[model samples]
Target: MIIPFWSRLRLAPRIVLVIIGALLAMKAVDKAMPLVIRPPEAMFFDRDWLLATLQDIRDRSITAPAAERPALLRDLPVRQWLDITLLSSPPDFRHSEREGGFTDLHRRITDRLGLTPQDVLLKADEPDDPEYSPRPLVIILPPLPTVIMDVFDDRSANMLSSDLRIAFRIGPQEDWLVVTPKSDGQEIVRMTRNVALPLLAVVLIGLLSVWVARGIVKPLDDLAEAAEKLGRDREPRLVGSFNAPELQAIGNSFNAMQLRLKRFVDDRLQMIAAISHDLRTPLTRLRLFAEYLPDPDQRRQVMSDIAEMEAMMSATLTFASTQLKDEPRSPSDLAAMLISLCDTAADAGCMVAYEGPDHARLVYRPVAMRRAFANLIDNGCKFGSHVWVRLRETPDAFVITVSDDGPGIPPDQFENAFRPFVRLESSRNRDTGGTGLGLTIAQDIILTHDGDIMLSAAPDTNGLVVTVTLPRQG
Candidate 1:
């Protein structure tokens, strides 16, 4: 199931998925690093150091005698963070225990001092109170000072203005530890930087992946377009060079294949043209010899047979010659051309009618297209009394249908009728079919113009319809 799913994805999307997977894997490694190995001091704050410093401050303040405790607290030589003053009367400020790491902090301080949890009280600063304003101060000691200051700048400082303040008594000494807690904002900034840097790296990696994928996929796209052109035209251009080694090899292979196909087709057409040219001399000599026969009926019979042979050879030569010829393209009124062909046929006593716009212009080989249409229209007249010619234009091509009211060929023999010299028995009577090359010639000319011709039964009639599709101008 996984294999099938993966196989369904296109190259570019698969490349993108691989890039995202790599980034996520890198992020997992990044998250796991602090647990597996210690990071540099700049990456995080040292919580152990903060806990030890708090404990040491408490020990020093408590060991001092009650009489000189206030002076000792003021001169404690600690980092300039807390306002360590002893109250003359019992403390007026009520301290309430708050949630989070501070609860554990309170417990740790009490356990180290060999006192109960009740002996220490931790409280958070209330910003809404008019009387109390918490000042932003740095407590983390040097070398680390610069790191913390850089991470927690003025914007973070403003957010951390309401700092946590803990007020607690040691025994009955009336001395309280008034200290600010660690900056939650600074920790938040450090964590965000950790996550954001990797995310930015992943974004850059994604962009690089897209660039590489496009480079790889572009050659394949060009190859597909070239294949389509090759189908429509014998002379399609070679694909451009590609950066990838595999794509370059494929392009070389495609160019070789095109050359082989073109050579094969040209060789076959040339051989047919040569064969038809060689047969004409013997055919002409036969006609001349038949004119000199003694019996008049025999002479007439031989001449008629020779004339039919000559007609067949002439048609084959013409079809081969047309296939080898290159016609220049020019803009012409397609409707007018069809109308003129129908009018000429009508003038010649064929019941043919044209139905389309007055002047729809398109780029095409004038002589080749006119000959192809003439062949189809003439075939329609030969097989059936009334012929209807209709022309319609689409955005990409022009569709022309020539329908006849004669008995249509069987569906099974529809394809066979387009083969050179292949005449169905139903239409093989000399009065109706000539040399069996009419449809073949029309198909050949249409194909040379990057178009197609198909034979089908006419809609709502028992007759044949020849549908010709020709490309429009650029």
Candidate 2:
């Protein structure tokens, strides 16, 4: 059964996306719901109380002075605000434009102050007092400009202050409650929803984005680890393709890359072998022609040079022919190969020995392995008094070390040994000679077989120790 592409997403980031999706859904609901409803109103005294207050003030006009007014007005809660309006009544008829819609109060004050029609009138709210009560209208005239008292908690009074309309009203002791038209409840709800809805949506989106990031990142990390193991020449560890299309493609491409590289190495080795055959023919002709030289020492020298040239060419060509094509037939016992190479070096009049384990194995080209070891042992014989070959094999790899008791190489020239055709001499004469390609060919062979070569000062033994580590076949 095939899984859908989205199913391949990992847990953590998917959770994040789900949370973001939820917030967006909430915001959508919030916006859609409120577009359907309307806006609440505030209320005060009933019609009976309003008309009665107006009638009482008309009948009981007080002859009381300002100081006596507060005491007498306090007898009725509604009466307290009447004294306030009486003090402010003169100016309320003045400054007519500031009166808002209270034209009734404006007319009353105009009569009391005996102001002509051209006199200005103003109206303003009463200052809040603990002892005073609410009175909803005021009118001002020019004579009363220095003081103001009465407009109240009524909404119409608020609207007048905000200059929405002209206020009109007609007396003191009258409870005419005014209302300012507004949809404040609806405005506040919309503001709250506008802020909350988007925040919820962003939270949901954040969750979803985190989920996607993790899903994409996880497969790539696995693919990278697999590639590294393949590059280090470890076992071919197979990773299953992901449900995601891009990740599957990446896995397929890496598998194809490995196949092409192996085939390329095989084809290249075949080409090198063909080139070696062409090189050998001319060298053979020169060896035959050297026999006709007249002087005895010169003839002997020519033969020696020809013999050395043949050996060097044969070694170099053998290296090129097999380095890439030699598929590892089986893991060979590494301990046995090193012991055998040391014995051969000893027979050639070099003091050589082996250290480390008796049985350690590695996957390699058998012929190439023997050749690389022979070159290293031969180099040891040329440069050192005594040679020791050591082995350190782990579950992952086997390292072969060759150390000697000869004079150490110069600190600067260690890497020079690995270059082809570049030779550093401890001996001045041109007598010690081979194709300067021996160490170079050995390194190439080890590298092709997924091994590494290193040269360092030998521990307490006074010369260089060359190490080669080949991966152990599992």
Error of 2 at 319 (Å): 3.5
lDDT by residue (329-383, candidate 2, tens digit) is 5778778888989998999899998998887766667777788888888888877
The digit string of per-residue lDDT tens for model 1 on 362-459 reads: 88888878888998998899889999999898889899999999888888999899888787978645655388888887877787777888989988
Estimated TM-score per prediction? 0.57, 0.47
What Cα-based lDDT does every candidate model obtain?
A: 0.70, 0.59
**TM-score of model number 2:** 0.47
lDDT of 2: 0.59
Candidate with the greatest TM-score versus the true structure: 1
